[model samples]
Target: MYLLSKALIFPPVTEADDDGLLAIGGDLSVERLILAYNSGIFPWFNQGEPIIWYSPSQRMVLFPNELKISKSMRQIIRKGTFSITFNRHFKEVISNCKQMYRPGQGGTWITDEMEQAYIELHKKGIAKSVEVWQNNSLVGGLYGIDLGHVFCGESMFSKVSNASKMAFIYLVQKLEKENYKLIDCQVYNNHLASLGAKEISRDSFINYLNKV
Candidate 1:
């Protein structure tokens, strides 16, 4: 699944074309990208390439009420050593996300182009961010799109232990306070599962989207 998702397939996607692939060679213009987010598609190509779109068979998501802040994480939160804020230095957040060293990972798909495109989205207020600071330095952050009540999470990174978890915890709490219904996490992986994100079949996910 990751292999297929990591490459441009044969056919390009049509506008709001949720079928197989969405436009393979499109630019990540704020207009196109925002449209994609609203329609459950997103660009995920590497550096020095035209944007490509994806609509997976299942969507991984977490309900605001479903966030599982583990006991250790709860302890971390109680420590109160980290400060979090919204829409703060979004480009810096993306850059910091790209630099994270994932164990057994070869490259980051965040890309220079995607970073700049999201920066433009941030400028347009279509994208929002959550940043975590520790000891006067950025230690964690995440960026995503806001479509009315649904927030489509793009990506996140942490420079310190438990930092990204802290950001996710805060996001769930904030959304719960605001009455937001869903955080569309986009795909399934072990990391997200541990944080309470779960897989819904594509049909069920789209049905949830309809509700949102």
Candidate 2:
């Protein structure tokens, strides 16, 4: 594994291992984090462990045109039971994501340092959040790094059923109107798959990043 130094640089994504682990031990500075996402790499590690960077050979992504909104989801949207906002309650949204419980997961990967770093990115207008509200109370939301043409999603949480889906669907619709290329999901997951996210080669993913 490659060990990073204080210098603001990262090895090429091609250098990542079979498991997509490219390097370890780098500070989550705003500059570095920006560089990482722009280069199609992201950090994922538990608290107390050295930051681990990954550039998977297979990248999960969703093209805006391909977003699947089921009949039920469409009904939910039509009902207007939930409202969506952009870049509102970002810290609160991420805080909920950090505390959200995923089956079989012992804890969250959003460490205090990571949280601060992303917040800094948000201040700089790089990180963005989508808040879902019901009755003026935050119910669900998602956050990610926006690269103009691509959005690299990080995490999302829901306080009620379909709340998180509401946030995601709204994001896809908004991005589609803006003519975005794709939403980088980072890895394959059933939830994203249901929304029409699919895996492509890392090389293909990087090609999109290069355009940003």
Candidate 3:
């Protein structure tokens, strides 16, 4: 593992440890965050810990064409019960994500500093958010780093059942229309798997990142 200095650089992803921890102690400046996502590395640590960077050997990703929408989700979409918007209410979306309680997790990885950092990224138009609303109230949403051809998904949350899925489905459809190569889900989980996201070798993922 490596320790990051003030310099805007990261060790090669190849040096990451078995758990994908590549480095620690980096600041989350907008420039560094942009470079990190473009290079296929991202920060993921709790609030009290030193900033940890990871480049997992197995990457979770979804090709826009491969996104799966279940029958119930499709029905909900057709009913027009939820509305979706991009880059709208970003801060709110992320705030909800920060406070959201996961099944087994005790704390959130989206620290206050991390929140401010990504907000800066949003100001620069490098990061984006998708908001899901029901009757003008924000219920679910997602946020990520947009690298043109490849979107590095950071996190998402839903207040109502399937609200986040609605946001995701919309984002995928939009990206597909724009010919995006893939959505980088970072690590794997059953939730993403159900949506057709699968693990690809880090090498393969880096290849996608290298696409011009």
Candidate 4:
């Protein structure tokens, strides 16, 4: 398997050879980091492994207006039971994400270094988090970076089956109110697809990303 070379990106839509791999090593400097995201690439690797970047042919994203909330979920929203907050308790949210293990999924990849780095970005207002609280306990949340009008979601976690969904629903509403353009779901998965995230060609994605 091959790997990315030095965090450098290939053509905007063209990814490095996918030998089940791409970049091998690189620092996540703020400049390179933002550039990578703008080009439809994102860093994801196991702890202790060199930073790897990926830009698959198909990208998953959510348009705020395109979100689909089910009838039952709508009923939950009517109760107003879960409280949503922004940029509050970011550390807790991330920690929970790191701890939750999905079935058949590998262990947490969000490392301490990554955590520290994102926290710095958050302090600088480049990153934001949406948290869900029930009965005074934080059961679900997500975090991501806000680049201009695009919100690049990183990860989320939920202890309750529908808790994260509630957080996502509230997040979309907040984004719509703020007039933010898109939510970069990063990769397609059954969970995200259920939330109405769709796949778009990488070129089209970068076109919209460049506008933001």
Tens digits of per-residue lDDT, candidate 2, 12-89, equal 899999999999987999999989999999999999999999999999999999999999988988899998899978
For model 4, what is the C-alpha lDDT against the true structure? 0.79
Q: Model 3, poorest ten-residue lDDT window?
A: 31-40
Q: How do the residues 42-141 of candidate 3 rate in per-residue lDDT, one tens digit apiece?
A: 9999979999999999999999999999999889999999988899788998999999999889899999999999999999998899999998999999
Runs in model 4 deviating more than 4 A are 1-13, 18-21
82-155, model 4: which lDDT tens digit per residue? 88898888888888888889788777788877787777777778878999989999989999888878888999
List candidate 1 stretches off by more than 4 Å.
1-22
* RMSD for each of the candidates: 4.9, 0.7, 0.7, 2.3
lDDT of 3: 0.94
lDDT (C-alpha) at residue 21 in model 3? 93
Alpha-carbon lDDT of model 1: 0.78
| Cα TM-score of candidate 2 | 0.98
TM-score of each: 0.86, 0.98, 0.99, 0.90
Error of 3 at 166 (Å): 0.2
C-alpha lDDT of all candidate models, in order = 0.78, 0.94, 0.94, 0.79
Poorest lDDT segment (10 consecutive residues) of candidate 1 = 1-10
